[model samples]
Target: MNLKSAWSRRSFLSSLGVASGSLLTSATAKAEGMFGKKPKAETKRLVDGNPIVPITSGLGSTGDIYAELGVKPLINIVGTVTVIGGSVMKPEVMELIRRGNEHFVLIDELEVAAGKFIARLCKSPAGYTGLVTGGAAAAMVVGYAAMMTEDLEERIKLCPDVATFPRNEVIIQKAHRYAFDHQIRQTGAKLVEVVTREEMIAAINPKTVAIHFTNIQSDRGQVSGPETVAIAKAHGIYTFNDASADVPPVSRLWEYPAVGFDMVTFSGGKDIQGPQASGILIGKEELIHWALLNMSPQEDRIGRCCKVGKETIFGLLKALEIFVNQDYDETLRMYDARAKLISDAIAKFGVTARPREFNPNALGNVTPRYSWQIDPTKLKITGQDVMQGLADTKPVGIGSFGAGAGGMRGRDPEAEARMKAHPELAQQRRRGNGPGRDPNTFGFAVWQLKDGEDQIIADRLVEIFSAAPKA
Candidate 1:
């Protein structure tokens, strides 16, 4: 049904059901933090830091979903990552998505309208446009196809079969060859790897259609952004960058394309807290025009297989708006406060936790996290044991609570390369014998935690340590 009809039905239901005022009040109460209200005697904390609070009393409505499903919900102290279901959507984004699902509109028409709005906010240049896709990987597929050909018939009909096309090669840095590059290759474009700036310059040829750059790999590559864009522009080749997680320095939303890349894709779900299946592709309008020609709701196109739903498109748009207007400083302060609370909970045990930069590489979650330094001699339990204990909890608490580089299970080649580039981080990772030696550290992040949940996490850690045998 159309949006108008849906709204009419909702209005009719509102009149028959409990009043809208009561519904609004219920929602407001659910949104408010339980701990934000003044504490009663039962909830009050004593000088010893332990509180006699009940878990179910002041908790919000989130428990309802897991409780009904019979799935225990764990406290996520890890930053936003896809494995943990990305970031939790804000109520505003979720509401738009719910409303969007009620509407019936031509998908292409929605793209045009939403694209215009996104383009305006992105400050896209004249001849530049913006479009949403089913996450960053899909954007790469669509964006690569757009730059490869302008023939509407070929794009609409038998596109991914680009053997007839001369633009068959995509140039990328060897260091930047991430798993996401598979998205670019899905369009039948061969990825030509290059190491040094000279190699990259040499790698470009008549077969080269576009150069792919990764913002996270920027620190690792020898070629600079200006150089990559300039070389691509000189040869009249397009540049597409996968900046899926390089946000907050939210200025990055526009900065990459504004500089020179022909197109750039950002994940809607990662830091933006948009729909998990949504993403934005912002770049040259001519290219975007071709991209839309190859996009969904269009039958005869290579991108027809990758369809983005209406709810995701509108939801991402609202999420982008909220992300753009968010008070970044205030958000950072909240994250720091969460980290501090976790740190303070374990202070008496001689384990010092503080907000510090955790991962500073392309593959890592580059953000400040609560890094805990443990004197293993003081506690019989090792950091890995602590990690295993947390993992064993009823509703498992997932965090960086292990004894490796950045608390990762095994060695990561990308982290190793990044460590080689920075001598100090390499030395820091080495506890004694060599680089792979287990470091006596564990960490947690608060960027993904919802309100009133930090205390739960802190209490969990305390419980784990309290049960540990004293050295």
Candidate 2:
């Protein structure tokens, strides 16, 4: 009866020959390109470009809980990972950013002033420099430039052009290859990916600008602090130890560089609670100096693009002072408590949930992950469903994907039962298609959860579970 149905008859078919056919095709096929065009591929950043998810006011500016037949969603128990723009700035950091915004000084002078302090904190020898960049990855690129060739002459020149100086190849292990390796290329340095101790050692040539050690322990090529620094030293190559999000178990604050790695990087926003756009690039003074020289406010410098607002730099320093001295053990205990909350929630669902303590020597950080074993006969969801469901939520959400080895959706016998038993109740489920109770997906993350939000979660879950049809 409508246009589509009307098109099936002979008259409609006859009309589809010439001019009419073109119009029909245009309407039928979306004017060739006029239909529902899918959105562009999404990046790590969120829709608004600013990456904070409002905890109190959600996507719709509604309260955390929807009427949900009378239920609120659960508080996040997950740590502040990317899906959530790292972590919130500590109050002290926020205040500093606010104050710094009020005035302007020579960015170069600011760099000079901050560098002195950063060098002292890292215990690097003089000429130790300070540079502010968007984050650790930015630091890697800028730092690479400094170690390669400093000053105007070589700063702009890249490898193959400078035969006399180090050609600047960054060595990374096969197993230790990281997502940020691409950052090194930004500086015109080539990345030589190697696997095994032999390949790593042999891979280093005179052209090598620096040897990069990704923070991890399990990979055979994963080096200890002493070994990594030692190898780079023998080759006269600068050593870069990248400990991206590996904070917590505070000893690491002084560990990597202390072991002699020439340079180190840390995220300011993670455990440090500094500004989200901030991070710490600590190590040899001279290299840092050169690195600092390459960033914004320095015209035509190879490191010119990455800019760290003066406020973010200052806030990072303050956050570091607090982070390095705070009661680290207390922080770990809080994480433990959060993990326990997730486990406790899962227990009611009849799933055996346990906290997996991460090894510091391995990944170089100490955070806990919640691993769950659900019996599938009772649950109908799949991990993919859960991830998609969470993403589809009004406010949208994110969490770890494919955590454990076994797939709960496919093999678990009581997965459905486990979903039903969850304390927060999966029955009425925040009232959308619940993540298909996927086995690979654990219930949810404890990362995003802050102080005092468990009850809303409990009530919401109960509502979801309560609404389900009786088996």
- Which number leads on lDDT? 1
Judge candidate 1 at residue 436 and give its lDDT: 59
| TM-score top scorer | 1
Model 1 whole-model lDDT (C-alpha atoms) = 0.76
Off by over 4 Å in 1: 1-72, 358-366, 396-438
Clashing pairs in 1: 127-285, 128-285, 156-300
lDDT against true structure, model 2:
0.62
- Residue 14 local lDDT, model 1: 48
**Model 1 poorest ten-residue lDDT run:** 44-53
**lDDT by residue (tens digit), candidate 1, 1-471:** 011112355455645453555566555665564647643223221121222222443332343545545654556666676665678899899877876776578998899888888888877766777899988888988889887867467644666788878788999998888989988888888999998988988888888898889877887988878889998898899998888988866777778788889998889888899988888999887888788878787777878877988889889999999999899778878988888887899888878874377443334355666678777778777665666566566744455323353365665769868887887786554432245535567665678888877877778779888888888
Model 2, stretches more than 4 Å misplaced? Answer: 1-78, 120-130, 157-166, 196-204, 222-225, 339-365, 371-444, 469-471
lDDT of 2 by residue, 328-364 (tens): 5676577567656645664564546544645644464
lDDT values, one for every candidate: 0.76, 0.62
